[model samples]
Target: MLILTWVFVVTAGLALAYAAASAIGAWRWSVAARNLVAELTAGRVAPAASRHHAAELAGLPAPVQRYFRAALTDGQPIVTAVSLTQSGLFNMSAVADQWKPFTATQAFATARPGFVWDANITLFPGVPVRVVDAFVAGEGLLRPTILGLYGLGTLQGTGEIARGELLRHFAESVWFPTALLPSQGVVWQAVDDTSANATMTDGPISVTMLFRFGVDDLITSVSVEGRATTVGTATVLMPWECRMSNYQTRDGMRVPLTGEALYITPQGEKPYFKGTIDTIVYEFAP
Candidate 1:
């Protein structure tokens, strides 16, 4: 009986320690996300334009103008800040396409082009990986941890990482359409009638993507050439694409509720992320 009792106590202690570590990890992530959001908000640039006007769309590409007309109502207030929650499936294996479930919360500052995305991916039944992808003040960060406690990798700096994160911010502008307007540092060029090229520059990095509009005038897909993709310890340039769907009105803006991200690899298209927005909140320019 004493032996059994000791075994039970050891098992219980192990479980308790595991639970404590998990909780602490979660708390650390929360604190990091909060601090990053504060920095992004404080470092935001003052708006050059506050509201959307139909007349301003005349000079943009035809498809871009159509998109804006359908996505925003006249005199719509420009989005300055945004926060959203998302749930999705992320492909874990680069070779096998093993998909894992994930949940994430993201915050964005439009004026200065910054964003922080905090995500937790379930690698196994009880193992979760926390990933924080962010860009601020022309720098980028990508950190991943096991249960938010044991660091797997922490990537940060300028150049490719920064450019990649900026590209992500620009592509995700579909969720907050006001950020894509011509006045918001996005220059649109004609690419046929159903597609357009959007170029956004932040500091020394400039990224461009081809945006395809559907018949309903909603953005169907965004594709870019030569986005930095990390393969092992080395990062390589690869073609990337994000497909969006399930249009819905949120805060008087038409935005995609679902999205999938993929890499155009030599073997063909390899998707890495499939996500749906669970809830979103917007703060417009006053």
Candidate 2:
């Protein structure tokens, strides 16, 4: 009886230590995230009207130029930073499994290609998961915790993951039309009458995406080659695409408020994320 009681005490002590460690880790993560956001916010500058000059649009393809004209006003302020709320369905598995509904709030800084997305994912009755996914200073991190105590998964890296996030930021530029201006990291090359190739570079990472516009001068789809995705335990480069629709004019800019992210594989295209933006607020330097 005494031995059993000692074993129980030891187990309980170990469990308490683990719980304490997890709590500390979570607190540190939150503090670091806040600091990163503050730093990005402090470095921003007000949007310059000169940056969106008509001359800059002269070199772009016709469709690309039309897209800029249709999406952004001539003197509209450039979106340096943005905060948005989104609700979506996220598929956790690739085997045609059920998709879990989620609501997320995100903040993005265009200059550094940094973003923080916090999501609440409902998997079952009374069981929900909190996910914090972020890309800061060329690092990508995804942390999902249950009940704020136990960690479900963590995928973090600086190479492939960071590249993937950079591509993601480029795709999401549709939501922040000013970021797609030629003055930004984006450079456009004519592909055809309705399509253009955009090369976006942030620091050492460079990615090219093909933008296809519809007759209305709205971007209908974006496709990127060599985007990274995780397959089982291996990280592989795959073709990825985002289909945009449901255009809405907000803050004097036309933007796609609904989109889906898909992975194009040899078998077929698998869409893993479908989201609708609820709100988008832009910020500039003071």
User: Which prediction has the highest lDDT against the true structure?
Assistant: 1
Per-prediction backbone clash count: 0, 0
Clashing pairs in 2: none
TM-score of each model, in listed order = 0.97, 0.85
lDDT of 1 by residue, 1-286 (tens): 9999999999999999999999999998889888988899899977789998888898888888889999999999999999999999999876668999999999999979999999999998888999999998889999999988899878799999999999999999999999999878799899899999999999888998999999999999999988888788888999999999999999899999999999988988889999999999999888
Worst 10 residues of 1 by lDDT: 91-100
Error of 2 at 246 (Å): 0.8
> 47 in model 2: Cα distance from truth in Å?
6.6
